[model samples]
Target chain A: MLDDVVFWVLAVVAVAAGVAVFRVDSMARATYALAVSFVAVGLVLLLFDLQFLGVITVLMMVMEMAIMAIYMIMFMGMNPALMPMSMVHAKRPSLAVAVVTFVVLASGAVLIPWPSRRGAPASDLTVSLGQALMGSKMLVMMTVSAVLFATIIGALVLAVPRGRYDRLGDDLRGRVDADQPDGAGQ
Target chain B: MTLQTVLLVAAALFSVGLYGAISQQVVVMVMMGLELMLNAVVLAAGGFWWFLSPAPDGQVLLLVVITAMTVEMAMGFAVATLLHRTRNEDMTDMATDLAQ
Candidate 1:
């Protein structure tokens, strides 16, 4: 009973905050609203005994939002100007799409014949998850690690303008190379 | 608690995200919509694992999805910044040059 109540409450918050994302004028608020929505979803996951996944979701989203905020500030990248800007476009058709999707998915959820439950879950779900990752799913772990490394390098290449030559000397080698605001040697 | 209830919430979140992604002009807002959609998938997956199968496969799938979401969001923001730098604007409308 309590589980149902908590789930519904979190569900409402997630949906409301999601709606707020597009309704808000500023980019910062929209980002934060999305973070809140994800955090609520993460909490909901905890109810299912997915402790690692749930906690990681909250932590990951918090870090992602913070990075987004910093990028917005540093690059003057987002719609942070004093002049307000409308965030939404194409209203009517979008509403129709949303309503249609909800109807379709809700009906499918209700009407579909689900398969019978399988074997019981282990007493320690987190242990099972960990073993699966480091065990048979080692390939996925390795692939994800590669992807994350690529993401870091790719993001830096695209987002950062400076290079060794730019920050360092023309020779591409300076011990105390000077680049204001954001230089190396940190 | 029940699979049906969790699935309902997930579907609702997905639709809301669909609306936001379609209606929003700003690139960041669009990305937020996409994230919400992904979040809905995470919830539904968790619900499935809890009530239906309770298997390792579902848990692994969720982890992969979460990783994908993180990578996608970071790349999206980076691309948005690059686009904004090029034209001093981030609205989807400004991207019409390619079509023309």
Candidate 2:
């Protein structure tokens, strides 16, 4: 009873915010809508007893949104606050495609024969997860994480315009903060 | 809640995401759309794991999906940043040429 009600409420909030992501005028507002949408979805995940993932989702999204806000300021500095820009294109065709995709997916969700519910989960779900991570699944987890690290370095290299030569002296032996040409690092 | 109900919610979220992804011309907006779609998939997977299977494997898969989604957005933003820096533009239409 209560679960159903909460589920419906959060699900509606999530969907509403998802729609607002595009309908809103400013880019910052769209990011806020997306963050709200995910937070609602995280709550729904918690309602479904996915405690860890739900919390992680909330944390990760908050941080991600902060990064997005910074990105907005970093790149779109023309209007300062409003952005005063509308970037949408091919409105009619996109709307048609969206409507068709929604109808097809929603109909499939309603009509398809899904699998039956299995037995209850283990008493200690987190313990089992930890054990699996340290056991057979260890390699995959470790490799994926290593790849994630590599991607971080790669992304930084690709995105940042400055390097050791620009920040430090030509010998790469400049002081921590004072040796740059611009005196801005200090 | 029933599995069907959860699945329906996921579908709705995915559709909204699709709409945004298609209609938006800004690169970051498109990435946000993709994030929302991936968010729907994560929730749906959680629903199936909770209501249908109660399996640890599904949870693991869900985590992987989450990781992939995060990495994808990060990479996308990196590319957007690069494009903005060099080209001083961030619209999808402005980024049409690949031969550069």
Candidate 3:
């Protein structure tokens, strides 16, 4: 009973917020609404007994939205959250396409007959997951980790304005300030 | 709802998100669209686990997708910062220099 209640509530909230994400006038409001939606869905996943995935989903979206907020502040620097701006560019055509696509895909989803379980669930579901992941999917996991690492390094390189050379002289500390030209800092 | 219903909802969400991603002008909106798409994928995984597999592996895959979303957001933000510094605009209309 509780699961059903949670599922319906979350499902409603997710759909509503997902739509509001595009409908909102302000960028910040949309970002937070989207985050809330994702977090709600994550909680629903937890209700399904997928504790690890649920927890990660909530954490991941919170952090991602926070970073997006920071970017909005730094780049737009005009509180795109408070101000109303039309984020949409090509409206009528995009709207038509979006509607058609949603109809076709949703139809496929309703029409398809999902498969049933072939066997009983593993005795220790978590342990089985870990074994399966490590036994066969270790390479994919490693690749993702490496990709994240590279992204961090690349982002650092791009976002930071000055390096060690700007703070300190080549030899040592000398109240140094490199007067770099525009478009040459990075 | 049943697994089929859950999947149908997920697919709808995914398609909506994809449409937004392809058509949205603002980069941040595009990113939000991407997040929505990822959310749909996660829902499908969870539904599969609940109805078809009932195992933790499907759940783990969903967790990995969450992690990937975080990474994508972080990288996107950093690039946005760089672009802002180079050009005083955030709209995709002004970003046509790359195409030119």
Q: Pick the candidate with the highest TM-score.
A: 2
The C-alpha lDDT values of all candidates are: 0.84, 0.83, 0.77
Instruction: Report how far off residue A22 is in candidate 2 (Å).
Output: 0.4
Instruction: Report how closely model 3 matches the true complex, as a DockQ value.
Output: 0.64
What lDDT tens digits, residue by residue, belong to model 2 across residues B12-96?
A: 8898888779888888889998999999999899888998898677767778888888898788888998899889888888988
Error of model 2, residue A103, in angstroms: 1.5
lDDT of 1 by residue, A1-186 (tens): 998899888989988988887777666777788889999999998998899999999999988877766665554543563435575778999999999999999998899988878888889888998899999998999999999999998888787766666677788677754546667665
Q: Candidate 2's residue-wise lDDT over A1-186, tens digit each? A: 999899999999999999988887788888888999999989998887778778888889878987887787777775424865578888888888877887888888789898888888777776766666778688868977997998898789778776666676788877655554454344
The CAPRI-style docking tier of model 2 reads medium
Task: Output the number of the lDDT-best candidate.
Answer: 1
Give lDDT tens digits, candidate 1, residues B47-93: 99988988887899999999999999989988887787767767677
Candidate 3 colliding pairs = none
Please state every model's RMSD to the true fold in angstroms: 3.4, 3.2, 3.9
Tens-digit lDDT track of model 3 for A1-186: 777777888888888888888888888888888888898889878876777678878887887788777776766668876888776777777777778877887777678776767566676666776776687778767877888899889889888876565465575565544465422233
User: Where in model 2 is the C-alpha error above 4 Å?
Assistant: A78-84, A164-186
The TM-score that candidate 2 achieves is 0.89
- Candidate 3: CAPRI quality band: medium
| Alpha carbon deviation, residue A21, candidate 2 (Å) | 0.4
